[model samples]
Target: MSYLFIILLAAVLVYIIFFRKKVVKAAEIAGVNYDELLDVHVPFYRFLELNEKNRFEKRVREFFREVRIEGVGTEVTDVDRVLIAASAVIPIFGFPEWKYKNLTNVILYPDTFDGEFQFEGGNRNILGMVGSGYMNGQMLLSRAALVRGFSSAAGKENTAIHEFVHLLDKSDGATDGVPANLQPPAFAAPWLHLMHVEMRRISAGKSDINPYALTNEAEFFAVAAEYFFEKPRQLQQKHPELYASLSSIFGQDPADGGGR
Candidate 1:
């Protein structure tokens, strides 16, 4: 009986290994070509300029190679191209584990899509949303919103960054914005304390963080992520302690790219 069980386990392991390999191959076949991806989603020349300015071109290319873009509606535009580039590149500066051989499908929407929400009493309402990201999974975006967010990094909130942050937080299991994979042992006390403090401050309307963060721990993590990447200098300058906590967690420095 034991021998039979061992044989069955070995067969199951082999089957799982084969299945995973097949799935990865299929994903590779469906992946967009590098040149084509650059043309349709982000112009190669523009990326070159960004790379030159930031000295992160090779890293950016490596990151995009792992992502797969899927256009949903009409042909992808120049604006769509730029936004996708930003989505693929910026996150990696903070989350290096994202390179772990997976496909992130980029879904484009012509405009804001209707998102339905049901309340406790069974009342439903539709809300217009620009974009959302699933953990290490897919990203949905609206061309118009993407343009606006990229054009004015200071004013318009970036939904792509916001949603992707949620995914990062969900890496551990729950979407509470505290990804278990990235959490360092040394940061446990400071992270918890500062997060609680910031949450309370936001709740009291004393923080620059979006009011949305006060909604929950997950939203707090997501909203903080948007600010961390988009307004790194400002966040670090104004909230050094909070920035320190974030830096410790992500193991990257946005404010000058040095260890905090």
Candidate 2:
């Protein structure tokens, strides 16, 4: 029995090591040129610098290596690289466990992609989806939105970060915005309470955050995350309590660049 146990343990160790290496390799193949990434978005350096402060920086690099960008139209110029990097990093910032794991592919359109949906009445129609951050495993963004977000430096309404935040929220099997891993016993009450209060305020138009956050809890979380990174000062100034709760849940301080 003891020998059998040892064998099982060894097998588990081997699997972990092998799987992790494969992930790293995949990431390398998918990563874009560092210089190209910088040229497209000047803020990319700041983000990279921030990542350097945390032990997770190396892992973040590896993760990017594995991500592939496809279906981007001609509108995707060199400048769009920053959006790609921001989309890749911001979501993982709140969930470091995603390192070495592929979050699937990112499909970029020139701007907002036309989406078609079928109504219950059997009528099929297409609608223009225009937004900075739209996520469903596949993240869609407008090139103009990406530029505005980076140039602003306020970080209050980053579409890439916002959409990816949704991806993180849905990682645990649901899009409810409450990431399961973040729902520790200690945080349960505070997260729920703050979310409820802030969401209500936004709905009432009493908050500076986008009113779309009032759509649901999941959206509340994603929109809050966008403000947390893009517009930290504004979010803190307007919603101190909500900012504090987010700081705790994400395990890092955007105000301080803890995880960058």
Instruction: Give per-model TM-scores.
Output: 0.65, 0.68
Query: Per-residue CA lDDT of candidate 2, range 1-260, in tens?
Result: 69999999999999999788677546444545555555345443464454442433444455455654544553444346445655566556556556424255555554444443222234423111222234433555555565666675544667666666666666666678677766676776668788888777777778888887888888789888877876666667778888888887676566654222
| Colliding residue pairs in candidate 2 | 27-65, 27-66, 154-230, 155-230, 155-231, 156-230, 156-231
- With candidate 2 superimposed using the best TM-score fit, by how many Å does residue 235's alpha carbon deviate from the native? 1.8
What is the C-alpha lDDT profile of model 1 across 157-232, one tens digit per residue?
Answer: 5677666565566556667656677776665666767788998888788888888787877777777876776666
* Model 2, position 147: C-alpha lDDT score: 63
State the C-alpha lDDT per candidate.
0.59, 0.60
The runs of at least 3 residues in candidate 1 whose Cα sits more than 4 Å from the true structure, single-residue gaps closed, are: 1-55, 94-97, 100-103, 116-136, 257-260
Candidate RMSDs in order: 8.0, 9.1
Candidate 1 TM-score, true structure as reference:
0.65
